[model samples]
Target: MKAWFARDYGRPDVLRLEEVAKPVPKPGEILVKVHATTVNSGDRRIRACDLPPGMKTLGRLALGWSRPRQPVLGTELSGVVEAVGQGVTRFSPGEAVYAFPGGRMGAHAEYVLLKETGPVAHLPEGVDMQTGAALCFGGTTALTFLRRGAVRAGQSMLVLGGAGAVGSAMVQLGKLAGAHVAATTSAGNLDLVRAHGADTVIDYQKTDIARLAERFEVIADTVEAMDFATAQKLLTPNGRYLAIAGTLKEMLGSLRKGPEGKRMIAGPADERIEDIVELGRLAALGQYRPHIDKIYAFTDMPAAHAHVDTGRKRGSVVVQVAQ
Candidate 1:
């Protein structure tokens, strides 16, 4: 099997494709011959050892001190089941599936092993492998935060950084939940954001968000650009502030009581089979389509990482791992 390995973190060039032994499924596990995977923001962060403020030591401890704990750096994948281990009756050889390993992080390869009961599900009919590979990370993250914020129909919701992968997902899910969605993005992505169902799109470069008089019942900051103070001012009373990307200080602030009934929601999103299943359902229904910015060949994964590092990618950057 061929896999991309990040032995040391620094630049995109650090990722090297090399021949590695194929993994065999253990008990209750299934081996997948990966067809497509994504190089998302999470991959870029891990590849560069980019940690939020005050989290470097903790990040190093969890990831690696001098090198990555897991050399393969992809988080989600879509593929065909090639083999199944003992007692794995949920899936069989030749079944198409998508799996979100999330922080487990070993999807950047020709083959991946997933537990039958993990965050793995069959690919919805008609959903291509690239789209399947792109769905989980952003979709699951958006769903988790929306649920945490208790977003409901008729309420106003604001999503900052609406052009990126997770941001776009948040906009779509928020609207699907019946909330009137407003999103912020660069001038270039105004149409893109609006196309994702945002009722109002604010051009961050042209309009200052701080000057806006409108307040939202739920404000999701996917760009880590909002401070608690700003969030407090922008949220209506009893509103929820979802810090989808927050600094370490803001993470600790999640423990502190907020003024009035407002609250801050910040933490890692849960990886659940149910969420993946729901995403598949939405895709099948044509209600949720993950935007793909580019597709790179497996051998060009390093270039994919470089593209994601630029911070301007409109959506998920997919890597075609197999034909």
Candidate 2:
């Protein structure tokens, strides 16, 4: 099996494709022949050790001190089950599946092994491998934050960096929750964000968000562009601020109560197998679709990483690992 390995953290070029021993499924696990996977912000951050301010040391301790603990640097994948281990009756060989080994990595290869009970599910019919590979990371993150904020019908919700994977998912999920959704993106992505169900789209490059008069009941910042102070002014009383990409300081602020009963929600999202199941159901119903910015060959994993590093992708950047 061929996998892209990131031995050291520096840049996209650090990734090197090499031949590695194929992994066999252990008990209660299934081995998948990967058809597609994604190079998302998580990959970029881990590959380059790009931690937010005040988090460098902690990130290093969690990830690795001098090199990555896991050389294979991918999180989600869509593939066909090639084999199933003992006692795994939930899935069979030849089934199409999507698995999110979120933070476990190792999807940037020809094959991957997933536990039968992990965050892995059948790829819904009519959803292609590319879309399946793109679904989990952003969808799960958005759903987790929305649930934490208790978003509801008729409320106004704002999504910053609305064109990125997580941001786009937030916009779509926010609308599905019946909230009046507004999003911020570059001028070129206004229509893109609107297409994802945002009722109002603001060009972040042209408009100063701090000066906007409108306030939102829930504000989800996916780009870490707005701090607690600025977001407080834009939020209605008792509103919730979702710091999806907050710095260490901002994340620690999650412990402190905001003025007037407002609150901040931060930290890593909890990945659940149920979330993957819901995303598959939504995709099958045509209610949720992951926006794919580009597709690269497996050998072009470095190029895919570079593209994601640009911070200009509208949504997911997929890599076709197999046919």
Candidate 3:
């Protein structure tokens, strides 16, 4: 089987495409023939070994002390079941599926084996493989924020990086959750964010976003670029700040805000399988939609990684693996 591997953690150049042995599923797992996969922010952090403080420590344990402990570096996949391991009753051969695989993180290949119990689910009959793969990270993360935070319909919500994958997902899901969604993006991607139900768009380059304020009930720091002190003013009295890329500094300030549900800080583990399933259900029912920015060939995984590394991507970027 063909796969991409990184010998050591460094850059996109460290990743190389090669022929590797196909993996068989263990009991309670299913072997998938990967059709589509995505480049997540987490994948980029792992590729360069530039993880956050806590993640860096975990990298030493799960990845490697000096280099990558696990050579493969991709997550969130949409594929078809090639074979099911014993005791896996949810799917059968040829069934279409998409999964997060969480800590497993081996979706950048022709085949990956994952447990049926994780953030994995069956693709609705109408959804394509590419969109399916894109759902795990963006879908689950947004759901977690909306669910765990103090957001309600008719409230105002702002997504700092609204044009990117996770940000766009937040815009869409935020709207679906009945909030008046606002997003930040370059002037070039304003239409992209607005198309996904964003009621307000801020061209981050043109003006100071913090100054133009309607106090928000929920402010999601998906990009982590905005300073918490300034962002605090945008929140309503009982507002919540769910930082997708929050830091220890922000967490402490949020902690100071005390019980009003003002500071809700959490890690990337914010994604849950149930949350993703709920997003899927909403998508299936036409209450939600995925607006893909572009698709790249699977062989151009390196280039795709490089593009995202620029930190100026629009909406969701996907890699078509099988087609």
lDDT of candidates 1 onward, in order = 0.93, 0.92, 0.79
Looking at model 3, the pairs that clash are: 63-69, 163-315
The clash numbers for all candidates, in the given order, read 0, 0, 2
Q: Per-candidate TM vs. native?
A: 0.99, 0.99, 0.93
Better of 2 and 3 by lDDT: 2
What is the lDDT, from 0 to 100, of the residue 270 in candidate 3? 61
- Per-residue lDDT of candidate 2, residues 1-323 (tens digit): 99999999989889999998988889999999999999999999999998888999999999999999998988999999999999999999999999999999889999999999988999989999999999999999999999989999999999999999999999988999999999999989999899999999999999999889998999999998888888899989999999999878877898987898788989898798898899999988888898999999998999999999999998999999888
Q: Which 10 consecutive residues of model 1 have the lowest summed lDDT? A: 248-257
Residue 248 error, candidate 1, Å: 1.9
Predict model 2's lDDT versus the native.
Answer: 0.92
> How far in Å is the alpha carbon of 114 misplaced in model 2?
0.7
Report residue 287 deviation for candidate 3 (angstroms): 3.1
The lDDT ranking, best first, is 1, 2, 3
What clash pairs does model 2 have? none
